[model samples]
Target chain A: MADITKSRTDTPTLWVERVHPAVWALGLVMLFMPAFANGFWLFQVFGWTFILGMIALSLMFLAGYGGMVSLIQMTVAALGGYGVAILGPSGVAQISLGLPWWLYVPLAIAIAALFATLVGALAVRTEGIYTIMITLAMASAFFYFTRQNYGIFNGYSGFNLVVPPQLFGVDWRQPVPFYYLTLGCAALAYAAVVYVARSPFGLALQGTRDNPRRMAALGFNVTAHRIAAYTFAGAIAAVGGILLVWQNAQIAPGTAGLPAVFDILVIAVVGGLRRPSGAFVGAFIYVLLRTFSPDVLTAFGLSNERFKMLIGFGFLAMVVFSPDGVLGLWDRWRARAGRRDPLTGKERG
Target chain B: MDGTNAMTSRLGAVSTGSALELRGVTKMFGALAAISDVTLTVRPGERRAVLGSNGAGKTTLFNCVTGDFLPTSGTIRLFGEDVTTFPAHERIRRGLRRTYQISLLFTGLSVADNVYLACRGVSRGRFSLLRPRRGDPLLTRSAELVEAVRLTAARDRLVSELSYGQQRQLEIALALAGAPRFILFDEPAAGLSPTERAELVAILTGLPSHIGFIIIEHDMDVALRVAESVTMMHNGRVFKEGTPAEIETDPEVQELYLGGGHG
Candidate 1:
């Protein structure tokens, strides 16, 4: 029994070894839903979840490991969306010559990374509450900049970019194809986040997070590691931005606004900040809530906008009650059930 | 000072020779001289102590050796390599590990986890995401260090839950985790009870001879008990260096510390 427990807990993967088989079955079922669901349901629900998950994964990498709770991940995603809209063949009045897909994608990623690096450069200098405030300030500034910049972003009225390129002559926007595309992007982002989280760089980042002075004494450059993490996270969020634009066939300042930015934080926190798996789980639950909550609220004679009250209250409750978030609660339940290995063991020393 | 002369006189005081050499090391913060032009050598396997009162620049000396602050003027070398300008991490990579005056374990983690973290090769370029940390060679080393410190009983306990002495033991274990060639202990017995202090002394004395140690201690008893040689520090300079008995009998050492003759 001890050997079995050790084998199950000691698996080299992330948190999957600890998950219940029923949860795995549910995930498998969800993955194949696009095959039966219509294009509207698939695109509006599953596609949005994937994009949100990818963005949350980026924030998870920075906040969970790097000790930086950045509020500008959505802002950087918007930069990527605008990068293509303004630089690709989409802007009403193109500022410069539009670039090819290959060039535009890489350029947008780089610009987004640079933008995140600058934000990290400032925010990394502060710790705890100050970091959150600084990043939030940056996010607010980005939101307003896109809102007021009529020449490029078209003010509040954003441009509708052409759909993503047909891969092998198959329209990727179709229900099944687009769902697969979103899944592919999300899985790739998840893999990358997990990979980076376990890498030497990730260990160093966590080490700095654990004890920056100790890490500094150990010869790790704390600030450089933080900036690198921010840049890496930005690149991931930019991928989500590309998917976001692809999903909606549009890029608006509103999508990159405060609500969207706060939504990224909500996804990360709701999922849990401790692991990359938290991103998908959090996004899945949040997307489910977003899609169905309005109807549920209306049935109860509450305004749809007031659904935010529920979300905000739920978020506060999670933080106040379970500081580690939903995954933490799940882990606690599994630990009690003896069906999964608990993350609470020995804590890492 | 006398320690400089004694270092040259004691043949084979260290087998691996000097890992760190300080020459005319001085540090001044604003108007106050925290450390005067004090010179010292830490030969491999040598267990030396710097005995000083408060504000005697013992901690300042450590800061300079660890590269926490660049010396106002002078040179520092590790393994005969100039490291005066090297940063703290660089110094650490070069095999210098130190414990602070205050215990500095990662309080958020378990005691075992804190030790494991310290043992991790932060400066090593090899990092793998696919591999679990269980296979790490350093983890076993950390386990061994934890066992050696008698912390295996509370290995799973959070660092915050440990007793004060246990935390100090963990701090030393953390310093040892990196497998540094030399370790610096700053007032390791500062707040410990008599029994706790004695246990810490035993731990320090039992350390393997391959690792050099420079201990800055306020408690003369603990310092003299574990240290092979004790150097008295007075006003930021080495006042005397001798066996514990010799230093104990020295009039200047007594006057510097207690303002009286040896008891």
Candidate 2:
């Protein structure tokens, strides 16, 4: 009966099977990572990668599934970071006078969400190149506003925030705690995105992307759906920001600047925009390269600064050869390889 | 096909409660009136064909009904509810669904996903965020409709990759996915081959009685095969209304549309 059920579901359909073996194997690698990796390396590189991956993953949900390419994800993250920093118990003199972390956290998330809503509303009014320009303009405006505002943002210096509240007497700044916290957030964010993508609203959002006119004819307000998608995307991105403040113990205008904004786009595009998992994969690769490239280049008898050139060339090559990004290419290769699972003895990814 | 499905040629289906009504509808693009003072009634289970030539107001009439453009003068009611002031999406929610002359589909998504999306639009409200799409009963219904349209073979293919005919089939599949009481087909057979066209005809003719449709077509034979009543539009107004045989034999229709002499 089980076999019959498996074949019945599998035959003549591309319904995504449960987590691929490759993903499972990767998860197992993560479980065993502490055995060999040093705390410092893991804390700085892997931790940052996962957080950035979460943010990029959120953007991927909007772009791939919702057919909206937003350039303001970094700005949203900055808002979240700023939210926590300014609202938490101790902030750089200008931002947070004194607010408990618990009260500050929710307030910051809400503010970030509201900020995202405004951006989504304005940006969604246009399509294609116009949308890109609008979002870019919004991001640029946010960057400048943060850079120049001394009263609320403390000018270019920004703010040094309190450590996130220690829960159950466990300090989150320690490497293991931070790593676990980041992993937990990433996992939750990933599951949420997948759940939403597979949800009725997600389907409708995609439908709006596919044919706004048809969706409208079917009683869907296309603009409203797009805005709602943006708001959802904002909430996810904002969570990453809260974590960002937790990690850096600070917030600055540079965090929301064009470079950071562009980096988020790079992470999402390089990760493979089609699936949520692509963001993590892309982030892992990006963080590894960005963190270690200087040392790796020096070891190879090159100037450390040359690493940026290499990264640029790599991005160019990836875009030219694989527009769908690495995960998409990997999926294509897997399909071509004709591999079958041992457990099921049927076609599976 | 049955007593319930039998054709009722009443001039106005409003007495039984119209699914849609367009009265004294007039539309102008700048100085040009694409349509003028037109009235149309789409009844429950009514299969209507709006027939016209290249410059005739066929698309214009459609635009007005779907709220793509508000008529200069007219009232559109759905199921006895006044809906002239409603926007396109509100009209859809009110049980009026439609397709386009061009197959407008989410080209990046799987065919199953496209239909599933449409079905969700019909079976649920637009704001349902908590309910997941996979394994949902209504989504299953969408998959069933995909099979009904004979698109099961290409269900997983991205809509962009499908052949033109398959895209049209998918388009109709999307329209039917919502299980709407009323559907508008704008030139459904525009680019289909003979076999595909016949298949479309069969699909349209075989739709369940609870559903209603208004079709716009240039192919007179296909229209004659499916539509219970024909509405001929020329110079914006509905020039004539009758069965297929009556329009084909009308001297005015023959002179203006079928050429100067009888075939």
Candidate 3:
């Protein structure tokens, strides 16, 4: 960038812009979360929410920042899950390479990122529904490829009991420890999304989203930015995938199924399509239904599978009421609040 | 492909080496010939206006030069480099920029961000995934450009919220961000009031003499005032080329272009 000078009053002089004091406070709170969450709720509920939310964050980043609605995020995550499965210790005979988790995790992320780049190069030219359809087609092909090719993906029954190894004298799979691990990673991914949103690359990407012709005319490579955004989104999804495998202790073809792919879309949209933090909020709501819906279904003399139906109803309501998701609702409500008094029904502004 | 052709015959203001030279550039859409065997040259830091009616291939010429559309058969040289095959972004990186006849902007972002992205587009720092968009040195350049375009008050506002005149000013500011060796403006005064057009003209005139420009405008008076030389185009060919004064007085040019310039 050119080294021109604007007003000193307008420009923020802070060099370390990513780490605000509040972020440190959030990190500190997250660091000590294990003290509050019991083992069952910690690993089975919140931990899974964080893991899925991280993956949804990748979609939110692409959809919100790049104006790209990719339906292949779960496919990318499944690729990462398979990476950990094939490359690490699992009960899949003749499949697991028994590599170190560190080695396998990075390898998984690389595979996912590579897949995303290829998909992006092929799909970036098409916009809106076409992009969604193309990515969906690719995702279906991948699912079939994994299912049919048992030599690597292990057919219908995927590698199971694939656990995280003890590192730094802590059993990583322990409920509290795993929850903390998931929280720490989730926080990092969240911070990264926020950071990237404020970065030069992110701004240029948003500019490309708004108007590619203008961005290209201004010397920014619009296609390159779009491709790079997908690659970045893939890496973030890969992280969620690794954590997901670590949490579930397995990997399978259904991981990247059509329903799973759209599940992420719902999670992202329900939270907010325009903000990163929305992913987490949406994931929490979705996971709550997953956790408690079985009991509710039983109380109503319905099958456990009906939980998804109930969730779908809620999802429909969310889409209809707040299409931009919760953040947009908040924005609308704030605007309304600014015009009317909060306690009394009188015009304020 | 020779630079010694009649394209550069008129020595305009700021005569450094040729900034852009097009030879035998032709573009066709099916049976329609948008540009046909047209050649032109632009010197560094010179203001040259393109005067033509609606179907005179003005936009097509600018598109081929800026790489928005590749010419079917041609050689476009930018700063002595053969750039006919270059992409739009690559051409921009090579110090060539242009504006759309209709304003195209990053409507989702602030005016400051729009200009800042333009400044940051060329530099290596645009890829940083963690840096702050605020406090960017490019933002300082953006601020300067905002002031130059008389958009300081609208700097923090969204592009969608700005009036049409403000949007046009922002369009010019975005082009200026790259500090291009050559800029091609397609109808800078297309949708502005008389007062706004005067302001737009003033902004273009206030630019440093070292900045080269190729402006295409139907407003002959404003185009002639900003430009040192004029290239009158007709049906995908250069009808005439001369200094603004010479073209204004030429009876042939009056019959072909200036007589119906308003519509």
Best by lDDT: 3
| Complex DockQ per candidate | 0.30, 0.47, 0.52
DockQ result, candidate 1: 0.30
Sorted into a CAPRI-style docking class, model 3 comes out as medium
Where is model 2 chain B poorest over a 10-residue stretch in terms of lDDT? Answer: B1-10
Which residue pairs show collisions in model 1? A219-B89, A348-B113, A349-B112, A349-B113, A349-B114
- The lDDT of each candidate is 0.79, 0.80, 0.85
Estimated TM-score for each candidate: 0.81, 0.87, 0.91
Residue lDDT tens for model 1, B1-263: 23323433443343336877999999999989999989887777888988878888899999999888999999998767788998887777667889988876666566656665566544345244443446456556667888988888888777778998898888888887655678889999978899988889888888878788989887878888878888788889987888888988788778778565446
Q: Which one wins by lDDT: 1 or 2?
A: 2
Ranking by DockQ: 3, 2, 1
Mark the 10 consecutive residues where model 1 chain A has the least summed lDDT: A1-10
Provide the interface RMSD of candidate 3 in angstroms, 1 decimal place: 4.7
* Candidate 3 lDDT, B47-124, residue by residue in tens: 999988899999999988988889999899887778889888888876677888999998888887788788888666
- Judged by DockQ, which candidate is best? 3
Q: lDDT per residue, candidate 3, A1-349, as tens digits?
A: 1121232335555545535587578667767767776898889898999999999999999999999999999999889888888988898859899999789888989998999999999889999999999999999999899889988898888889788877888988999988988888898999798777767898888988888887888888889899999999999999899889888898888888898999999999999988888899899989999999999889989998998898799789989998988778887987887899768978785
